[model samples]
Target chain A: MSDHHKETFISKYVFSLDHKMIAKQFLITGMFMGIIGMLMSIMFRLQLSNPGESFAVLEWFLGSKWAPGGILDPNMYLSLVTMHGTILVFWVLTAGLTGTFANFLIPLQIGARDMASGFMNMLSYWFFFAATIILLCSLFVETGPASAGWTIYPPLSALPQAIPGSGLGQDLWLVSIALFIVSSLLGGLNYIVTILNLRTKGMSMSRLPLTMWAILITAILGVLSFPVLLAAALLLIFDRSFGTSFYLSDIIIGGEALHHTGGSPVLFEHLFWFLGHPEVYIILLPSLGIVSEVMSVNTRKPIFGYKAMVGAMLAIAFLSFIVWGHHMFITGMDPFLGSVFTFTTLLIAIPSAVKVFNYLATLWKGSIRFTPAMLFTIGFVSTFITGGLTGLILGDSALDINVHDTYFVVGHFHIVMGLSAIYGMFSGVYHWFPKMYGRMMNKKLGYLHFWVTFIAAYGVFFPMHFLGLAGLPRRYYTNSAFPMFDNLTDINSIITFFAIVGGLVQLVFVFNFFYSIFKGTKASENPWESNTLEWTTPVERIHGNWPGEIPTVHRWPYDYSKPGADKDFVMQTEPLKEGKTEH
Target chain B: MSTSKNNTSKQLLWIAMAGIFMFFAGLTSAVIVRSAEHGWDSIDMPIWFWYSTAAIILSSLLLIIAKWQVKKGNSPSIYVLGALALGLFFGYCQVKGWDQLTAMGMYFVGEGSNPSSSFLYVITFAHLVHVIGGLVALIITSVKSLQSKYTKDNYLGIELVSIYWHFLDVLWVYLFVFLLYSVK
Candidate 1:
């Protein structure tokens, strides 16, 4: 095939090795998966709101067999909750958010043409796609999806007869997670090598954008952490299929003694949470980095304390590894280790506080654009703050005991990980929509998307704090078993109503995402007016990022509103002005 | 740029080699931890396994010599023979190791002995499985040497294969020492 013809639809769109196309694929798939996860949460919310009410909606969607006469089955509720959390957290957040942005931005922002291994980059997405399919397949299993919690804690997960969902659905869950971990490993390896080896001429590590720093450290965490999860999955597989008890012992299944003689479930928790804790930041720091990039540009001010911002990020990443025990304080862990974990966990707040302060400080007394991208950045910082402060509450060993499995924990994490990351995803879509699609998203719909989502998200989660304070436990199919929980039904109903609206508000954003791709206003070449190198390239993305010899970097990416600069911002590849510090 | 290109490729191969090494190291750590738990089982070390370990060490020597012959611009007929002998030696050692485990009543994918022993066999066998890929590379490197694709200044291809082969040798030694000291 001629070079021109060789670049046909199959090569360019489907099997294309360009990182940008791959990133687009990740974004689109993540949105699709995110909708599924969000819709499940809304469905569960409805059930929680009106327990013992008609199961008509679920039955209509899940079929009469699943709903069982318009009443949501307890097993189905647990299954949906498990799969919902699984998809949003792992499938959407880690792979979709981190994988896409890391692939696209790492090479571009770091000044490489493409990933270190473009073929492997393509394989990484396909593997993630396959894993997503396997996870979706669990929803169709006859016995139902994995109901053993998202953590898949054993004894519950290990015994075949522990719950009906454990029969085939838990098996599928393990297989899906194992596959996802492999996909993550492959992707992580490429990110590490590309950033380490493929930087553009003159783009040193210190001069790199904070986004690159976040991705680099996050990739390192994935590399060091994911294998432990693979190990955990393999052991669980051995227990499930091969009858080896690496993670189970002394459990009676259906009142019969299990063959598993001597194993520790705590070991599995240790391994799972080793990957699990870093995973929270793995989903978080990249979004934080994006907000940093967007905020500085929109404000047209040099990011306040660039060094301190990067330092806080590094501090957060370093501290993320040790706080796994906070998740397990109520898992009956040794009380002494709780202090160790609580201290590390709460210490995370200091750096996190520094980041939030830096963002607000950047916005302080500066020219700030309320563009949808900027709006989402502000939304992220807002949610990040509201969500992050309560983390200190749950981060405390004593306070966590009161609210461990309560909706407080749910509200805290959802605000931080859920809303914060999704806002990050949206901010990127609006900020780089011009670059990615060569068109601008409709600002009217974009703002509407921002306001509705912002309000509905708070409206949904804020009541959750009340329910938590009212001592409502999470993962309960119906809390009617306890008479004391009856008073909180009003709060559950209010939150559920808000959750449905929140779920629906995302439709506006989704419509904008697709509609804007082909039909929105034509974007200026540098729509966000940022100093990042990506804007220096052609609007029409090509296989090699630049058309000629690579552009050389001459300044830092966050150079906004510097003294004696002709423009408020400076392009990374521009020659330095006469007499000034580079930054 | 061209020379560094090949070295970068060599560096990539090194990273991949390190990746494979990490898998084995994790497996060994699992083995140590799993066996220390309750209901532990210990099995006698197989006798022929010692001989296989010795044979693999000797094969590393032959691989080095084979690479050296290609470097010296000599006809590699002797090196080819030595490499073939070493490849066969390594494969033979792997089978004998399995057989010796069988003779000692340890089995992978079977009921006899604890799963810990099965894990030992699996980890070692898995490492050997990856070594087969390396062995194939050595064969291709031997053949490429015959075609004069490498010279003293541009011998990164041969050098990389030899380095990976040596790593496998060292990795196997580490596994052996670990199994020897930790299992009993």
Candidate 2:
């Protein structure tokens, strides 16, 4: 209700209640976390490629304790791997992608002044910040960060005796995750409510941008699924701290009989993957949303098959819940149940194929602008296809048993979920940089960032598939144990080279992002000439998005290249010409 | 800021309730699966649990009456306080129930514990934690009603708290039946 107000620096920037400011907060924090995650990956990549070799950088970053004699300790290697996955998946992709875009676009695109409860949105970012602090603080603990992989499966994650990282680091990991879940739930609730209840006049659910639909569904998925992760993590906490055996059973750690019995780790697996599988979509759907909007704008065409895209995303979200069992197939589940999981898992391919076809069809013969955002959108599709194909192989229970935790699985997820989502985030940052910062990022730097990342991403992950097929299990400190795997050493070295290149290329983006905020070219009101409500607002940031009255949406967001339209793109606020039916 | 005629807070509460439902759904499913495993010792439902269940049910009834009073343009502070009292009573009974289980040699963890008893303690404790949240909302609502912050036409606060309290009440009923059926 209070749109116009004089503000101090603290109210405006630090603890702002404005959704746009909050979105920027999420973005900066996510990028900070992303750099840390990327650095961790490069550290482990070096260790993996050049086993037993000393790296001065590792000692510099990790200090002499974890990297004595400049070589990474075996336990610390697992910590790097674990924190890398945790940070990238949860902090960078899930929180960063949805947290940034959803907050920025939901109000502006939907014609609202702010989130339903601006205070809650601020709390969401602060909670995420707190969670980030705790998780980062975990790395400095005496033992190490949680190292039982990001999955944090127990017996390993449960007992400090099993792994040194399990002691305080795992406890902090659970607490941080619990707070992160709360932050996401708070943000998710606001997203769902604002999108549903705050749309301007004439903006029906069907007429809203695909980004809104994707984000709304993504928020819903987070709401339903993340609590299960909270549940799983809580039980794991009890197992670790309270001497409960929710996951641990019949243990003989250090040649001593434990009092715990009857608890099954499979129960933990069931609960974890329930959230874990949906968590993948929670990371990807926002990107899918952003890509749809970016492709529609850059290609100068209405997104093809809008209804089908909505239906397909819904289908994917629904299937995501059922298909989580595919991740646990090798846990000795019944063959019948595994078959059911396999069937459900592959059914996702249908909707996924529909989405891919829609993106291709949208691009077919359209006047495509080869902007940096468009390049990453195209890259996202490429990696989504490349990574999704391997999913078919991994989804089968019989086939998965052979390579469940191998480098193939690693390659598969990194390409599909990791690369694809990161590309979507980059696409979003480039496309909406003007709206977020009121300035343009350097196009040359953007192009350089996209090209190097694209090549290095494929270079890094594509070879891991072959190594996985060759039976190189993932998360190994060194594959120097068996001479049978000796021949794959060169490929690991190649992958590591690409990995380092990819990790470094992100700096081009970081520099472009920060530099453009202050010194880059001042943006026009609508640089992309997009047909969305967000582009209708002034370039300067304001508490309420629009200066005067919020414009009422008159048509769908995608109205590019309509016949008889004077311009190629039509803003959603424009009245249709007489007898011009809305799309 | 929003011009639409939608009840956003209600929608948010319902969505949050769905998430909370999933949370308990996860815990209950774990209970069923773990009960089928070896070395699970089934424990009887603690006597105080039934009393706590009744307290929460009656607490919901008081909130219903409070809502009715608001609709009639009367102060609902007394009924709201009644609901808060019963909410506190429900929490007390839950602790007593856990105490009763300890007396029965059923423990949450450590020596002489079983997974069945652990699930019981954790699920009920989690529910009680939520009940405490509901009690906090109840306190705020009763205080606001005393200050006449709500009226016949303006009772979103009362309505929201009622919805959440009823959901928790219903949730406890579901858990009670589920624990009765599965925890044995």
Question: Which has the greatest DockQ?
Answer: 2
Please tell me what DockQ candidate 2 reaches.
Answer: 0.82
TM-score, candidate number 2: 0.99
Among residues 3 or more apart in sequence or in different chains, the pairs in candidate 2 whose N, CA or C atoms overlap within 3 Å are none
> Which sections of candidate 1 miss by over 4 Å?
A1-6, B1-37, B48-115, B118-122, B162-171
TM-score of chain A of each: 0.97, 0.99
Tens-digit lDDT string for candidate 1 (A184-275): 87788788788877888989888888888888888877877777677677777777787766666677756887767656787778778877
DockQ of each: 0.28, 0.82
**TM-scores of the candidates in the order shown:** 0.92, 0.99
Instruction: Give the clash count for model 2.
Output: 0
lDDT of every predicted structure (CA atoms): 0.81, 0.93
Residue B131 accuracy (lDDT) in model 2:
85
